[model samples]
Target: MADVMDIVIVASAFGMDAVRAQGHLKCAQASRRAGAAGFEVRRELFAGEAEAAPQRLRALGCAIAELGLWSVFSTPAALYTADGRLDAAALRLAFDEASALGARFVKLQLGGFVRDAAGAEIAEQTQDSNVRLVVENGQLAEGGSLTQFVGLFDALAREEHAHVLGMTFDIGNWAWRDVAPLEAAAQLAPHVEYIHCKTTMGEGARRFSAAPAADDTRFIAVLDRLPRDVPRGIEFPLDATRVEADAAHYVEWLAAV
Candidate 1:
């Protein structure tokens, strides 16, 4: 068997609708009970704006820390704006929110990133922060395409800014962009420090996030290519009725895989 990876249960996997109904506090308890090594808090999942306030986040952080699970903060906001400029205010808020939560990493989408001199600014913004930022390939071509990632990383490298940025490689996201996961892993694995474990299930092109089956060779193949030391997050949907069992099962299975 290969080395086991740490499993991080993304709160949204419990279902966005369900989370909105109960809030993430309950989910955090379940995650720790399932023996997850970490938990990912979705910014978009917060029930209200006040729930994400700094003081509330600090309290949540304390609660999570007491459970003995490390955390990662995820924001739906993209790292760049539509015009290819760095969303500095968005970036700063993300860091503040993640920092308040005492998270190890803040995950963001690589949005509208056109290669330019602005890539270097990432280092300056992150230098004083305790939390690190890792950009993920989203479902669209603008920031989610393989070519886009390669270009962004390349530009940052030229400016010596690559060291400050890392990737959250989502295996299932490639399908949305019509890109092959294995091919992406082959090129982007070097920069990947985290993984989102997902496989699509559908009757046609309109697929949805589903847990990878035990015998799923495609998931294993892509996972094998990424860094073994990196953490794996269960981003796929968990059975709503059996969230406990499903969460526990994947937490163990994903780690062993």
Candidate 2:
């Protein structure tokens, strides 16, 4: 079994966009102070700081767990030209960023079919690179649903790319899409290599809250179904004034898991 204490603190939880607007150095420093095993790096959070960000994070003893990119491969406008084809150039850039960050995996949202030519191309391209690719369930329609993920993985299996591809399951995202977390967990556990731990409250306009919220028992069920070896991390909003304390609480909560 894996030690839950190894839970990472995702940078975005701490107002990452705002931090990026200012800088990434502070975010890295703060993560270290909070005693996180590592931090998930979103491309937006390192806009102008990518060159120096890795070194700074390393200096503070923070590892780069994953590199997040926001490309919708299904949409020609997003990753391809008007002719409607995979934009190898854009895809390479995403891989390049993941490589530069030294992340174990490049995490992306599953916005389309894995059986698509572009998706197959992604698997082939990634096989030659050090950084692995993982698709996550995003909280919007564009992101894809649990059913879509199952189909994607099944297709990857048929193409023999399932061994190379994996998943990053977001606990709260199931709620966002109106899917029961535990049900999704049972179906996606086999491919999950990373996890996003957070709880959501309300219905139409849901909001993020720390894990283990009184009304949210989904985490308990989902956690039980997850592979113990995977990296499970907190991805909820953090109180800036109590960053360290908030982070510590999350770690402690995971420890008790």
lDDT per residue for candidate 2 within 38-105, as digits (tens), equals: 56666556555444344553432233233221111111112333343555666666666666556666
RMSD for each of the candidates: 1.3, 5.3
Ten contiguous residues with the weakest lDDT in model 1: 114-123
lDDT of 1: 0.90
**Which regions in candidate 2 have their CA more than 4 angstroms from the true location?**
1-5, 47-88, 114-120, 206-210, 214-216
- For all candidates, the clash counts are 0, 0
lDDT score of residue 129 within candidate 2: 85
TM-score of each: 0.97, 0.79
Q: Write the per-residue lDDT of candidate 1 for residues 1-257, one digit (tens) a residue.
A: 86867889999899998888988878889998898989999999988999889999999898998999899999999998989999999999999999999999999999999877275577789999989899999988778999989888888888877778899999998889889999999999999999999988773466788889999998899998899999999999889889899999999898888
Note the Cα lDDT for every prediction shown. Answer: 0.90, 0.64
As for candidate 1, its clashing pairs are none
Structure candidate 2, residue pairs in collision: none
